[model samples]
Target: MEIGFEELPVMNLAFVIDKSGSMNAADKMGWVKDAFGIFIDRVRDIDFVSLVVFDSSAR
Candidate 1:
């Protein structure tokens, strides 16, 4: 089936992450960063994404 082009509703997403001492184990922190990068790349094609990481403070 063929579909027509149309404007969809806008969406906002927030990713809250904790970069505490526990996140330092098993390279989990690095993995998180990499995964975020990949996520940005993928979502960049469809929607706008915002990333927020929190430790003792928020960014």
Candidate 2:
């Protein structure tokens, strides 16, 4: 089935990622950044995305 913007409801998405100690391990952070880049390339024009990364002691 074909879907159009006018026929669909608007959406808001929030991605909350943990940037704690573990995420800073070897290449793990890099991988996450790379994957996010790919995701942006694929969906940049299709939808709005908000990235929210948090650490153990901070927002």
Candidate 3:
């Protein structure tokens, strides 16, 4: 059995991203951004998302 998008339920997603100075190392920040972009692409239109970025702080 398989479930299609029409049968899927709404979702709520919360992402806590790390933006410390080290994140810039090895292009980690860029990689995370690209990965998150793909993740966002997979979200349903009715879903909700909250992104919190932190680096020795929360904003």
- Choose the strongest candidate by TM-score: 3
TM-score per prediction, in order, is 0.67, 0.65, 0.88
Expressed as tens digits, the lDDT of each residue in 1-59 for candidate 2 is 99975555545667788898888778788988898888766553556788888886535
Per-residue alpha-carbon lDDT of model 3 for 1-59, expressed as tens digits?
A: 99998688888889999999999889999999999999998888899999999999999
Number of clashing residue pairs in every model? 0, 0, 0
lDDT of each: 0.76, 0.74, 0.93
Off by over 4 Å in 3: none
With a 3 Å backbone cut-off (N, CA, C), the pairs that clash in candidate 2 are: none
Candidate 2 local lDDT, residue 20:
87
- lDDT of model 2 at position 43: 59
Global Cα lDDT for candidate 2: 0.74
Indicate the worst ten consecutive residues by lDDT in candidate 1.
2-11
